[model samples]
Target: MTGSLRGILCVLLSAASPAALRRAFMRRQDEQRKGGPTMWRLRTLASMILLGILGILLATVLIGGILDVRLSRATLDHQYEERARIAASTVADIPEIRTAVLDGDRNRIIQPLAQRLIAGTGASYIVVTDRDGLRFSHPNPQQIGRRLEEPVSVLDGRSHVGIDHGSLGQSANGKAPIVDGRGRVVGQVSVGILENQVAHQLDEEIEAIALYSAIALAAGAAVAMLLTRAVKRVTFGLELREIASLLQEREAMLHGIREGVIGMDAKGRVNLVNDEARRLLGITANAIGQQLDELVPAGRLRRVLAGRDAGADLSVLTDDALLVANHRPVVVGGRPIGSIVTLRDRTELEALIRRMHAVTGLSNALRAQEHEFTNRLHVLVGLLDLGETDEARQYLADLASDQLISAEDLRSRIGPPVVAALVLAKLAVAAESDVDLSVTADSHLDAPAADAQTLMTIIGNLIDNALDAVSAQSGPRRVTLQLRDDDHHVRMVVSDNGPGISAEAVEEIFTDGYSTKSPRGEMRRGMGLALVRRLVYRRNGTIDVSPGPGARFEIRLPLSSLDPVASARTEVSEESR
Candidate 1:
């Protein structure tokens, strides 16, 4: 129903003048970009409502007056016809009139009686006629003893009422028969009231009806005005066109943004969701008006969306995307209304950052190697200049043995080339930071699982976190990593010995956006462990934090089949080779 109304309003608004349309279009765009207040110069809603009400009242008055006039005329005709019948019946029953008519003296006695009756009963005329239709009495004395043109209608001894065109004028007329002592019809009596007299009475009634109608119309107009004021107040005095333009701007803004937007009521029901939100959350448009618990599964995402776990830049891992969300509470008139949450997809950005870090680490290692070689060459040249040939030979032997042993040991211990490279880079970074970072002697692993990216994220974040933890502490900072793989599962343990984690921070450290470190410019903190937890959980793995002298994290993941994309890439690379 609401959609249909909006469509109708759109059609009507489109039919407006072209200049108005252009103005409205420009205003809508400005509001969407800068959120300016609405200004409408068109007809106000109050005026339209007032005009409509007045038109209705006018039409009602005209129709009602016409109907009232017709009904009043009908009533007057019936009433006067009945009055004439009664008068004629009274004259016919008089004994004097009967005797006068019987004696053929109607012309002498009845004419004066008829004149008296015409004055008393308000009739136009009274006529008395014999059985042969010869008029014995009439309003005109000259016509009294003349014969009537028509036959006596009441010769059957019955009373009759109808309209008559007599000598006086058209009138409501009635007739009755006068009987003798033998019960035989002797004569006829007729009475009539003029149509003009009935018309005068109808005019008086019409005046009264019109007065009442005017009073009702005035009352209706007053009520309509009051109602219009109330409606205007409710709408904040916005014209119909302004309201429609705001609606259009709202729709365009909500759908045009790249960030996902969700609006919820105070009761935690979703009231609005933009297209980006629906797509990022893997939900349909039907999610609107549903509770957060219903739209999203029970997890960190649902908790963050419901404002149960409130924070800015909180990271949530959905089924297919990693999202950063910010929650802001909405207030209106100093009362809590609801909240709005904005989401950004960081999956691609995070991947790029990781690759950049890897490249940076490789460059750092090369630089370190070049510096060490240059120092060694300086020593060799000095030894040669001092003529200590035997000492230089022993120094070369020591350097060669040290480099070959370390490289051979790491390659034999870690079978995957990527993992070996990652450890070597971390070792160089650890040396640069004056921290002892090493792999356990018993650590052993086969080639990586097909989902190597997941492994890299988990291993990289854990190792970097351990390094950061120790870098800030004094004295001997040490970090250790152990990896093991079997037919069914892979296991990892990373522990650092610096200022160890406090008991209170054991569970909190894994929460998104909760960091012990100070904030960096524009960069979010404390998302690493949150990402690890989500990935491990998704793969049906278990992770536990043991009581720590330094922080110790242990994880075990069940092995799975190769990733299709990774497998395809490997096949293509092998064919090229």
Candidate 2:
């Protein structure tokens, strides 16, 4: 028992031993990191799984063997018992045996009959006995005429059957009384089968049982090993505890971030929508399992959520917010199985970009002015070198006068210096493009300084687009900019006398990717109008384009109720000038 138990321990330890050693090694290195690398190597997991299969196989074999022995013993006992009973009954009813018992003769009758019956049936013993339980016939000739000392049930003159130990050895036995001619009990007949013979028969049954049990155990273990391998593949050989920890961390990280995140399944249904995503789209938790079309109803955002293509850096405008969004498909094994979308607020970023573009335009205007001044200086020096001092002075005077008149006209018509600077910069841009740029006399504004980018983004894109439209015209390539402000609203108009927009483009002109010019080498085209519409919509403003010989765009935005400090500052700046 001790040796067997030690062997089983060896097998169990063989499976668990490698992982235990690895874990100890990892602990020795724990000071370097919070935890050591995992011990869930392919070999260690295999050993563990094999050990489990071995335990199951051992259990099945042991239980099956025990049951097989008990059942085989029972079957053998019942079979031999019935055989002895039938043989004994046949002998008792024989006519020769009955006559011999009445005549008290064995040599002439019972001896031959007992010998013949034993030969035909292969019973271990067949004997005749008188009423006193004395044997008249026996298979061993030397045992003839001997008195049987053991108790016999047939001696009571009734049939009997049971297991009994006699001179023949332990056997299943049956006894019956032989009758005289008067139908009286005269003597007895006994038949028995040796227990050794029954045991040998049971041995064969056990061997067969062991064979089948071994086959079934091997099949079961093989199935278990295959299943273990499949599990390892699916989990990438990670332990259950490790996998569970990662899942928890993933959930917390996804939900903890401030940016909106949305996850969709292959069928384009919402699978994961974090709190920020829910708030951004104005949907509830019930949005999960809904189609993307149902969650994002707007045109631009819907295209992104539907995963129409691999989207990148898209702009989306909701009811009151502007967002920069990115959408991408989640691919696995070279197949697109899902999608992820991320979003962030872009109001501040757009404002910053607006200011940068305004500064850049102003710098370009200054460079152009510098170049023009250098040319005038060269011409004035030439006039003086030719001894035309009077002509040179008049030229300088004329240049100064023109600069003053332009500045005065801009200062009077535009109240804000930034707006005047933007207009002046655009006029230089128009001059570089060889187009006539004009500001109407009625232009006027008294907006706060903080609203400069808002106005710049709206007017800059329009003016730049208008300049491009008339830059290549054959005849009068002209553009007009008009700005007006009142207590309630601010309005602007940009009209260009270039080749007019076709009626077919009116419906889709403000949509993304809509452009009349063929993009030969440009990185971007047609995004200007879309951005204009998004900015206008976010601020609750209105824009309209009237069809004409050229394009005419008009915009109106609500004037904020000015605070006392801001109103005072505006007046002070105006009074200081």
Candidate 3:
């Protein structure tokens, strides 16, 4: 249960612990079965990344190989064409070959020369033709005297290079014109290399291209594998499906829980804040990725969240809520990561406790009154037994006048019924304790303050502290409470004739969790004066304490109200100014 609770509560990197990741993986596997085999079929994020990179590299290699093959073929053709052109032009420029072709008996001389050049230069064949389109020399000697069936290309006396279908086979062929000394075109020289030879050259280039491409593909695959490993480590070896599932679960758990949860990084940046946290902290804007101090106001709340003020169930007073916060630091792999602070709103619970305290006080007052009534009855019974009727009657008259005189006076002076009841209860308690507790005659309250609860808290805490102060005294004990109300503010004063706060203790009295009193069970002390001070200041009020032979505390809290007439007049006056 502890492990699961920590997993659900903390959103730091620790959330990706091995156990949690395994659970997430199991959940993903179940989801995959439900969704079908195609869902997250790759299983691991690293495998998927590797496969994607390999696929891309494979496609790139294939496309590149095709383009390279095309380019190689074109280059081979150009090379062959250039070779044929050079061979034909060289033979045409020869005075012997040109004279022999023009003489019309060139087979004897040209056939041997063409064969020799073919052996040396690797030309497939060379054909000499006159202007009349008659072949002078051919690789086939039987066709040496035959006129060429095709028209003679030198009729225009220009050289040409292109594919040719000859008796030998299709080849890259170039034709060059042979001219006499008068510069008149007489015949043509054709030189060619077989298509098979060109294809052979192209095949060699394709082999090299394929080898290079394979190497590139291999390098790319290696890189992809290394990249995948890095990503896997970073993601804590969780698959994509697992990560998504964890995120969904985290969101559900974070916002679903009633307690406010805040997750911060080691650097004091807010990484996660749930809906309840936002509502409890009164944070309206997005807080993720923001600095903790920037989002939370500088106070006990911020200090606690930032781990500066550390403790369990540390009470934090916010603008409108009283919160009990517990800060837990999260460490992963023995390294400090960050922390998670859970805030539970204690405002309502604290209010109920205070109300219960009021009821308890009133109950004690009733008990005290009952005890006093019993003693009076005993006196009356004793007087009747002694036969002193006039004395008994007079005693009854005095008891009737004194009975509830303080209650009547309190009701007349205090306006709010709750405050009146609380004070009356305290009065009875003080009387029972043999301490003099009185409300000043000059004290009066017209109505309740706007934030009467805060007002009551301030007054109540002061009075309680005063009673505690007086309770320690050996001699006469007195506690005085004075309340004054006006249109703008409510003032309260509580003083006691007891051992006053020492000069050193007075300075620290209003510090949270700083109590001089002995520990009482599990009850936390020192918050009362601190809380009273906070409430007074929050209401733009002032509190003054006099270190006592007896302690005296005075508080004045401003009343918040809207008067349209006064507001409008003030605005007009400001405009004129």
Candidate 4:
């Protein structure tokens, strides 16, 4: 039965006009669209206002009802008191009542006459009493001759009106004195009106107050609805879900990227700084909503944010990290919104680029050597084709001898093929760069100092740097390399006749991103020397630079096991001298 009843109710509702139902559906959709903060605040405000109005109306009604009840009771009490007094006065003036009370006769006078008076006046009770506070008559037969519940007020020579309890419960009662011809009071007559009729009028007043309060509540609700509609109009119609989705998308995009991103509003506050940005700049989480200049002081970043400075490839150095930043203004609707700063780490990329440069240098050097060897072969071919067989033979013999000497020289100097190859490669690179690479005669190493790769990196970077140093010099650009190895140590010295390093800069040259080679308006160097220092130190080596007319760098590496270079050293000293 319950299911069938529910089905019938659903069908009845669904059978309503389609247009009306469609309008209701559209209204619900519209409410959902405009249901974000503006509508929420509207609902809250309207509810509060409506509640306040209803509360005030109810309070007023309650107070009025209480006051009306009290006033009506007072009025009814006054009327009943007047009625009781009039009845008591009239009864006391009656000859029979006066005679009944004075005679104290229950059967013939006081009781029977009091009953007649109560019946005629519609009073709750009527009583006749003597001046000595003894009752002559009462409605209850058992108390017909008993003394009155309270002392007689008429005995004090005054009429009395009051509310008191008696046999018929509580009532408004009035007492009057009965006097004889000589004006001496003999007895008293009392009349009472029930309290219920007085209070019944107060109930009517309360009911009227309740009805008015309900009407006021309904009116207040209508006003609240009007105000709510006004608030809905002010909201510009945005769905709560749409706003949330937009906020969530913004948060996800800002946090998902690896690059550091910072956003500033038009008020110069950091409004959208992300985790990566905080990590890069050493900024704390509380930097949000703080002044941008306070978080990242007035510097390159500040200038970039302002219109005074702008660049896509600008580099900024923070507390510990070097950031390559791209900054641009965020414009919207032909108006400037704010600005966004995108930062990428440049120190790692610089290291990678420097390593690639070394590899390319090695390849270029090999190509140069290959070309030189081909030219030599062409010369031998030309000699043989000219029918100068003997000259060709001598040339070939001299070439073989030179090759043998070069091989022996390499063997005598550094026996390790990787070190030899690196040196040969650097030689071509230096030549191509228009710098003369001179290997001093005193340089000799019978074995490898450390790993070939380590030595290659150390020697390659130093030679490249030395070559760079001399490239700026005007005349006879020259770099000298010296190597010496013994049982305990392998030493390398690379010097150049260039402008040389400053005393102050030499100490800082090996620090990451601290470059002495600053090009015109560029900031991408100094990683090579830092790499060289790191590799040398890893093998427990020492590197030093001598302050001179040209820069000279010396490094000494501890060898695990090395052959003696004393004999070769003596021969090299003699030959050079």
lDDT of 2 by residue, 277-329 (tens): 77877886497567787766768668765655344766555554556678866
Which of candidates 1 and 2 reaches a greater lDDT?
A: 1
lDDT of 3 at 564: 28
- lDDT tens per residue, model 4, 1-577: 3233222222222222334334444655776587877647455433555567667766776787678667877887888998899999988899877766566765556777778778899888888878876777777888866787677788766788988787687889898999977788988888998878666765776677668767876777677667545533332232344334444555666678888877665555666667888887878659766777787777555665444555466655444455677776654324454566778866555545555766777778778778888998899899889988899899889988977776567666887887886787677788777788978888887664455555566677788788888888788999999988888888999999988888988877776455666653233655557656655665578999987689999999888522224223322211111
TM-score of each: 0.63, 0.53, 0.68, 0.46
The lDDT per prediction is: 0.76, 0.71, 0.76, 0.69
lDDT of 3 by residue, 82-145 (tens): 8899899999999989879777863478888888888988898998888887877788988887
lDDT of 1 by residue, 192-282 (tens): 9998898789889989999999998999999888877766544435467676775576577677789898877667767677789989898
Error of 3 at 145 (Å): 5.4
Clashes of each: 0, 0, 0, 0
Candidate 3 — which pairs collide?
Answer: none
Candidate 4, residue 461: Cα displacement in angstroms equals: 1.5
Q: Where is model 4 more than 4 Å wrong at Cα?
A: 1-246, 261-341, 345-371, 444-449, 485-490, 514-523, 534-541, 557-577
TM-score of 3: 0.68
Where does the lowest 10-residue lDDT sum fall in candidate 4?
Answer: 568-577
